[model samples]
Target: MPSSRISEEITFRKLEALLAFMETGNLAKAAEALEVSTVSVHRALHSLEEGMRCALFRHEGRNLLPTEAAHVLADVARDVLKSMAEGIRETREAAGYSADQLKIGSLYSLTIRTVPQVVIGIKTRRPDLQAELVLGSNADLLYKLKQGAIDAALTGMPEPDPEIESIPLFEDDIFFAAPADSRFARMEAIDLRLCRDEPFVSLGEGFVTSSGFMEAFRIADFTPNIVMKVGDIFSLMNLVGGGIGYTLLPGRVRDMAAGNIALIPLTAEFDMKQTIGLSFLRRRERDPNLLALAAVCRMTRIAR
Candidate 1:
C-alpha cells in the first residue's frame, strides 16, 4: 500500500477490525464479534498490515496469531475508537440532536433553590425534555462544561476561559456562619477582622466559595486559623452549626441554616459576593436545550 493511502485510508472500521482480531485471537471469532464474515476480518487485517508496511499476524493452521505490532495497534485503536465515540456524542449534543435529554451541571449549593427552579421551568416549556442534573463544585462543573460532558452549568463566574460563555444569573451576598449562641452571632453584622483569631471550617481550594472565603481573610489582612477543609458546603455548614468552627457562605445557604447556626451578613470594605451564572461552551449556543435552560435562568427569580 502507498504511504498516502495509509495516511488517509486507515479508517475507524479498520482499527475496529484490528482490535477485535487481537482480542479474540481468531478470524472467525473476530468476525462474529464484529458481525461480519471471517473473510472480511482477514481482508481488513491484511489491508491494515499492508498499509502500515508491517506484519500484524502469523497464521498457523486455521488460527491467526497476533504479533507484538498487533498488540500496540490494538491499544492505539481502543483510544481512537473511544475518542471517536465521545466526539460523536458531543457533536450530536452541540447540534441539539439529543432525544429529549438535557444534561445540566450545577453547584451543590444551588440544588436547594436555583437548580430545582431551572429544572421545573425547562420541564414546563418542553414537556418531552428530560433534565439530568449533575451537582459538583464550581471548578468541577466548569471542567465538565469545557469537556462537553454537560450541556450547561450553573456555577460561580469562573476565571474567563475563552471556550466558555457565561450568562450571569444573579449575585449572592457572602455571610459569616457561626454557632447561634456565640457572641459573634448575636451581632447585627460581623466585622471581618474580629474573626482573625477564630477557628474556621472552609471548603476545599477548588471551590469558588473557598476563593471568596480566602479573599475576605486577605482583605482583613489576617490568615484565618483554618481547622478543617471539607468537600461540600452542607458538611462545612453542619460543622459550623455543631460548633466545630465558623465558615463563610453565600446568602443562598441561609435557607438550610440549622437552628444552632447563625448567618450574619458581612460588613466590610471589600464586598464579598459570588456571581452565579449559567455556563456552556460558546459553540453550543445553538443547542435548543441549552437555549431553553438559559431562558429559564433569565426568567426565574433566584431567591438570593
Candidate 2:
C-alpha cells in the first residue's frame, strides 16, 4: 500500500474495531462490544488489512485465525489509541474549550452552602462559563474525581494521594443535633463523654460526616449507641427532631435545622472538625476550568 493510502484509509474507528476483534476473538462479540453491527466490524477489519497491505488474519473453516502480524499491530494500536485520547484531552485543555464548562463534584451536605458560593464565584469571574454540580457522599465524589467524571470536587480532606492535589478551603466544627426538648439541647456545649449512653443517628460509612462522628467517639473512648444509619444529613436531622436519636453535623447546617431540632456546639475536648476543600487530579493543574474553580474556592469564604 502507498504511504498516502495508509494515512488516508487507516482511521481510528477501523483501528478500534481491529483491537476489539483481536480481544474478543469473534466478529459478533466485537460488534456487540463496539455497539456496531457484525457487517460493520468485518468491513472495518477488511479496510484496515487493505490499508496495511498485509494479511492480518486467515480463515480456518468457520474461525478467523489472527496472524503474528495481527498481534503486533494490536499492541501498537492500543498505545496509539491511548496517545490519541491524551492528545485530545491536552488539546482541549490548552485551547480553553473546557473552560466554557466546569464539572464539579461535592458532598450533598455542602450543596446547601459552600458549593453554591463556589459556583457563584466562578460564574462571577467568567460569565460565559457553565457549571454542572454532582452531589454524593465523600467516597463517591473522590472516586468520580479520580475517574475524570468531574473536573474537581468540594469535599472533606481526603488522605494524601500523590495523584490528587487538595486545597483546604476552611475548617468546619461539627455540632451535635438533638430534639429541642431534650436535656442535652439545654446545654451551651456538650462533651462527647456526656452523651456516651445516648442513642445516636449516624450518617452511613461512606459519608465524610460519618468519619468525623466516629473520630469523636474514638477520642471520647466510647462507641455510640447508634440506632439508625442514614444516607443523608436531612434524614438524620429529622430523626433527631422526632426524638429517635441524636446526630452530629457541621455548623453550616444550622440554617436548615428544623425548629424542633437544636444544634449544640461541642466542648473544646470534643472539638471535631472536618477540613472542607477543593480537590482535583494533580495532572489537571493546567486545565483552565479547574484552575478557575480552584481560584474561586480559595478566595470565597463559606459561612460557618
Model 1 per-residue lDDT at 168: 92
lDDT of 1 by residue, 47-81 (tens): 88877778888878866788889888889899989
Checking candidate 2 for backbone clashes, the offending pairs are none
* Candidate 1 C-alpha error for residue 96, in Å: 6.3
Model 2 misplaced regions, further than 4 Å: 1-99, 302-304
TM-score per model over all chains:
0.68, 0.68
Tens-digit lDDT string for candidate 2 (131-204): 98888888998999888788888889999999999999988889989899999898999888988778999988
The best candidate in terms of lDDT: 2
Q: How accurate is candidate 1 locally (lDDT)?
A: 0.85
Q: Candidate 2: lDDT of 6?
A: 53
lDDT of each: 0.85, 0.87
